[model samples]
Target: MQTPRDFTELSMISKTRWQDEELQYFQHALSQILPYINSEGLTILHEINKEIYTRAEKQDSQYT
Candidate 1:
């Protein structure tokens, strides 16, 4: 899957809908799911988010 940033670069209508729908879906899904995630998993996910952005910026960062 394209990193989330790829969706942000789309047209306003698309970005808006993405923020509105897909983001909401992910948020809701995460909400239902995060409680089941251990702290280590949470930390790993945080790192993944950081890595995704870093990769987006320089296009050279390897995702951990």
Candidate 2:
């Protein structure tokens, strides 16, 4: 398992990543799915994001 110190030791980003660049990666990550889904469907990704964060927080609390 990676320790908190291990992650803290990572270097800072060399360059600022633009919003479009981040969205491009986000879109590309979903490329395997059908193109029919619209922005409405994308909103649910936020819920999924929240759930993952919540679970991560729970795990972190247990560890800490």
Candidate 3:
């Protein structure tokens, strides 16, 4: 699948529709490339993952 060239196109879709398998595939793909990516790419991934996990933790706490 082709990704949108514009960042705004990403906001048009809902991430809630993503399947666990698709998330796992992306995570695995990122892990494989982590070793080859430059520092800037690594920093970007780290920041994004940090936000994702932080939001997930907050959501989980709300259910408890």
Candidate 4:
């Protein structure tokens, strides 16, 4: 189970730039804790996923 502090940290982290490795770490962490989190956490998870997808799109565009 994740603590409220964990969610707070994640929320703060979500607002900043992330290296690919760090993003992957949090992505996995969030998925693992999904079943245990509240609706607010779910919202944060969606935000993280959106960030990941957005970054991927940017990287892909650079290669095109």
Candidate 5:
């Protein structure tokens, strides 16, 4: 299980700009910690997932 500090750091990161690779790295990290995280962490995870999906959709549209 991760500490609250871990979730806090991830939450901060989610609010900033993310490169594609960085987003993938954190996304995987969130998935690994999901089972052990609190409600706030879950909320951060959902926010990150939404960002990932939004970015993917934008990229796909550019190619279409």
Candidate 6:
């Protein structure tokens, strides 16, 4: 029988897996249109890039 903790961990793992799959799908879609984004999409992509850069900096700081 699964304990409550086991169920919670499994739920989190499932959510993470779903998120990773979605991210991959979006990445592949983006790769198809290599340099032809509209203005609004460009803005959104810029925000995403900024967020990724910020998170990478935070992770680097943690390791340093």
Please report the candidate that would top TM-score against the real structure. Answer: 5
TM-score of every prediction relative to native = 0.39, 0.42, 0.52, 0.70, 0.71, 0.51
As for candidate 2, its clashing pairs are none
Judged by whole-model lDDT over C-alpha atoms, candidate 1 comes out at 0.48
On lDDT, the stronger of 2 and 5 is: 5
Model 1's C-alpha root-mean-square deviation from the true structure amounts to 11.3
Least well predicted 10-residue stretch by lDDT in candidate 6 = 1-10
lDDT of each: 0.48, 0.42, 0.55, 0.70, 0.71, 0.49
lDDT of 2 at 44: 37
Which residues of candidate 1, in runs, are more than 4 Å off? 1-32, 59-64
> Which ten contiguous residues of candidate 4 have the minimum total lDDT?
1-10
**Candidate 1, clashing residue pairs?**
none
Return the candidate ranking by TM-score, descending: 5, 4, 3, 6, 2, 1
Q: List the residue pairs that clash in candidate 4.
A: none
Clashes per candidate (backbone, < 3 Å): 0, 0, 0, 0, 0, 0
lDDT of 3 by residue, 1-64 (tens): 4432332442244434443344344455567899898996576456546555766899899999
Q: After superposition, which runs of candidate 6 have C-alpha atoms over 4 Å from their true positions?
A: 1-28
Residue-wise C-alpha lDDT for candidate 2, range 11-63, written one tens digit per residue: 13211222334433334444546376678546534543454556568879999
With a 3 Å backbone cut-off (N, CA, C), the pairs that clash in candidate 5 are none
Candidate 1 lDDT over residue span 1-64, tens digit each: 3335342353234222343334444444445678798886566445445544544666554542
Rank the candidate models, highest lDDT first.
Answer: 5, 4, 3, 6, 1, 2
The list of candidate 2 runs beyond 4 A from truth reads 1-31, 34-36
What tens digits encode model 4's per-residue C-alpha lDDT throughout 12-45? 6644465566556667887999999999878777
- Model 2: residue 33 alpha-carbon error in angstroms: 3.4
